[model samples]
Target: MQDGTVERMPRQDDAIRNLTMVVYILQIVNLFGVPGAIVGVIINYVKRDEARDTLWDSHFSWQIRTFWWALLGAAISYPLIILFGLGFLTGALVWCWYVYRIVRGFLAFNDGKPLPR
Candidate 1:
């Protein structure tokens, strides 16, 4: 401790923590629309300072993008399946892909690798 010196917390780490929490919270909302994805994008942008150190930022970005796409896929596929009598396969595939993206993102984040692009 030095005179007139106050220890400062790491801003990057704080941003990472906040962004990660936001992503998890949004996951539970289940709407998975552009609005939610936009929040995720905002979180990532706010936390970009830590993106290099924490791969989670990249993963979060990917998750947000994938979520939006998955939602679109569901919107297009569900009605077609019902009207054409294709069963639930299309919807199920979209859901499975969404889950895969989220899980893969989590794994990459936890692996401590450098952020992708």
Candidate 2:
């Protein structure tokens, strides 16, 4: 109000938005890898019920889907790599796709845009 801003965000929304970024950052860091990502997903799921009425719910959904699909890709492709030496390419492509999704979601969150379903 002192700055004469027309609108202000609630503290809860701010926290949700910040946490969304943390999840994405943890995944991209790759040292935590999927396990770190799993932690993020668990947080998302636990907070998701509270998030249901807020804009940040979209982020939770986006992150959860991203984690599962990436896991599926790794599970399927790694075996191919181990057995036939052919899954490496697929695995790399999947990883790239996951990165893209994470970046896209982050950008949307930053821009205050709703993620596409």
Candidate 3:
């Protein structure tokens, strides 16, 4: 029987995990047509280097992609809205997709798993 010792996660790991959680929350708060999402993406870009070569890097990429893609989807939806009124449907679909991404990322992050590249 070796001497008892309990290994614990490093402080940086905790900080990265907490930061990811904050980004997810910000994305959710984005539903209110605010700048929260923009702020979150900015954080991801600025701090992503801290996560490089680690599991958290995938999440950083995932969040950034989610933000840009959702923005593109919204941009397209606006034009469609004016042209054919189909944008409402498309917008709703985009919202669903965005929610799905955020939820999926949050779940994976919570489980200490990485998102697909």
Question: Per-residue error at 100 for model 3, in Å?
Answer: 0.5
Cα error of candidate 1 at position 41, Å: 5.3
Residue 21 in model 1: lDDT: 57
List runs of model 2 lying over 4 Å from the truth.
1-10, 31-34
Supply every candidate's count of residue pairs whose N, Cα or C atoms clash at under 3 angstroms: 0, 0, 0
lDDT tens digits, residue span 70-99, model 3: 999999999999999999999999999999
TM-score per model over all chains: 0.63, 0.84, 0.88
Candidate that scores best on TM-score:
3
Q: What is every candidate's alpha-carbon RMSD to the true fold? A: 4.5, 3.2, 3.6
Report the error of model 3 at residue 31, Å: 1.4
Candidates ranked by lDDT: 3, 2, 1
Instruction: Tell me how far the alpha carbon of residue 89 in candidate 2 is from the true structure, in angstroms, after superposition.
Output: 0.9
lDDT of each: 0.65, 0.84, 0.91
Higher lDDT: candidate 2 or 3? 3
Model 2 agreement with the true structure over 67-92: per-residue lDDT tens digits: 99999999999999989988999899
